[model samples]
Target: MRPEDVSALALLLPGVVEAAHQGHPDFRIGGRIFATLWVEEERVVLKLTPGDQEHLLAEAPDLFAPVPGAWGRRGWTNLDLWDADEAVLRDALLAAWRNVAPAALDGD
Candidate 1:
């Protein structure tokens, strides 16, 4: 998948909005960023739980990794788009979106 593909998937989530953050495109739900497109890096970053980040990293190191520094410590992850699988990407996006999406939006 590419950055556009990631952006498109993120926009599909309910209440998701596209905005710029520090010059990069960020996807948010209720104003909380869930994903970002790091254009120069050619990577898509997702807001996941630390546990999920570890799991995904271990499961697919070639496609997923921690974003680095404080943000990463707080569950931010970078996905290598060129090696990412569509199904995995969709699942990852949903998980990230759900992390910030209101409970009602998630049917909870």
Candidate 2:
């Protein structure tokens, strides 16, 4: 997947918007960031539960890894766009979006 592909998929989620933060492109729902495009690193970061991060990392170490420091401990995962499978990436994005999305907006 490409950076544009990440942005496009993110926008497909309900109430998601693209915004710039700290020089990176971020995706948010209800004003909370759920994902970020780390352009310089050529990766996409997704906010996930630590367990989810661990599972993904274990399952696809080449495509997924922790973001490092406190953020990583808090479940921030960095995905290599060039290495990630589209289906897996979409699932991760949806999960992150749902995690941060307001209840009503999440339709849950």
Candidate 3:
């Protein structure tokens, strides 16, 4: 999928807002970042659950991975290359919300 497609799907989550700073794209809910992205080099980094990084790596080793440095151990996965469809990203992003955001903040 394209970056635009990812952004579009992310916006579907309630209360999600797109903001850019430090040249990175971030998705926020309740004024907090649920997902952050770096489009340079065609990569989208998602702040995910600590339990999910290994699962994603084991399942889609090539497409999903942990973010480098401190986040790598905490389950932040990066979606490298826009090679997948919106469905995949949607699920991943929702997972991120489930981890970092309160359900109340992500309305209908």
Candidate 4:
């Protein structure tokens, strides 16, 4: 999927807002960042739980990878936008959104 596609899909989630972070576009829920777009690099950073990060890394290493260093070990992942499948990206976005969205807005 493309960067715009990723942005569009991310905004479809509940309470999601687009904002700038570190000179990059970021998606937030309940004011907490869940994803960041590194457009120039053709990658998106996702904040996921360590378990989810591990599963995705093992399952789709080509499309998803750790961000590097301590942040990566703490569940920050990098998604290769050009290689990402729309459906898989959508699922990952949802997982990331849910990771930081407040419980009341989680649609439990």
Candidate 5:
């Protein structure tokens, strides 16, 4: 999916907010970012669950890759839009919520 589509889908989550600071799109809950749309890079960086993260990278390293810099070793993954679509993109947002939101709110 395109960045704008991801931005729209992100808004469907509860307590989610969008902010444009430092010239990039940030989707947050409780003032913390769950996903980000890098305008310059045309990429969507999402925070995924630890177990889910490992599974995706190990199973489909080509479709998803680790985010550079901070959080690389944590639960962040990057999706290249060349082969991306809304269904896969929406699942990425769900994964982002699992990483950024609290376990109490995630329903275990």
Candidate 6:
């Protein structure tokens, strides 16, 4: 997957929008960031639950990792675009979206 591919997939989720954040593009829902693209690094950051982050990291170390330090401990994760396909990216993105999405947006 590429940065554009990640952005495309992230925007596919309901109520999602892309915005600039600290020189990078971030995906958000209800004004809260769910994911961010690091174009030059070929990676994306997903705001996930600690459990979800652990599962993904344990399952695919090459594809997922904590963002490092305090943020990572709180469930911020880094995903390597080159190591993931659409299905994997989509699932991860959905999880991130849901993590921050409003209650009314749940279960859809």
In model 5, the runs with Cα more than 4 Å from the true position are 103-105
Full ranking by lDDT: 4, 6, 2, 1, 5, 3
Poorest 10 consecutive residues by lDDT, candidate 5: 79-88
For residue 77, give model 5's deviation from the true position in Å.
Answer: 1.4
lDDT of predicted model 2? 0.90
Q: Find the 10 residues in a row with the least total lDDT in model 2.
A: 80-89
lDDT of each: 0.89, 0.90, 0.77, 0.93, 0.78, 0.92
Model 1 over residues 1-108: C-alpha lDDT tens digits? 888888888888899999988899999988899998987777889999998888888989899988879999989999988888788899899989888889999987
Write one digit per residue (lDDT tens) for candidate 2, span 21-100: 89899999878999999876779999999988988889899899898899999999999998777898899999898879
- In the order shown, the candidates' Cα RMSDs to the true structure are 1.0, 1.0, 2.1, 0.8, 1.9, 1.0
Residues 49-93, model 3: lDDT tens digits: 777777778878889978778878887778875676666788888
Candidate 6 TM-score, C-alpha based: 0.96
Q: Could you tell me the lDDT of residue 49 within candidate 4?
A: 98
Is candidate 1 or 3 superior in lDDT? 1
lDDT (Cα) of model 1: 0.89
lDDT digits (tens) for residues 1-108 of candidate 5: 577787889998777889875678889988888888886666787788667778877866777888776686787888775577778777878888767787777787
Q: Which of the two, 2 or 3, has more TM-score? A: 2
Tens digits of per-residue lDDT, candidate 4, 1-108, equal 888988999999989999999999999987899999999888899999999999998899889989889999999999999988899899999989999998888867
In model 3, which range of ten residues has the least summed lDDT?
99-108
The per-residue C-alpha lDDT of model 2 at residue 31 equals: 85
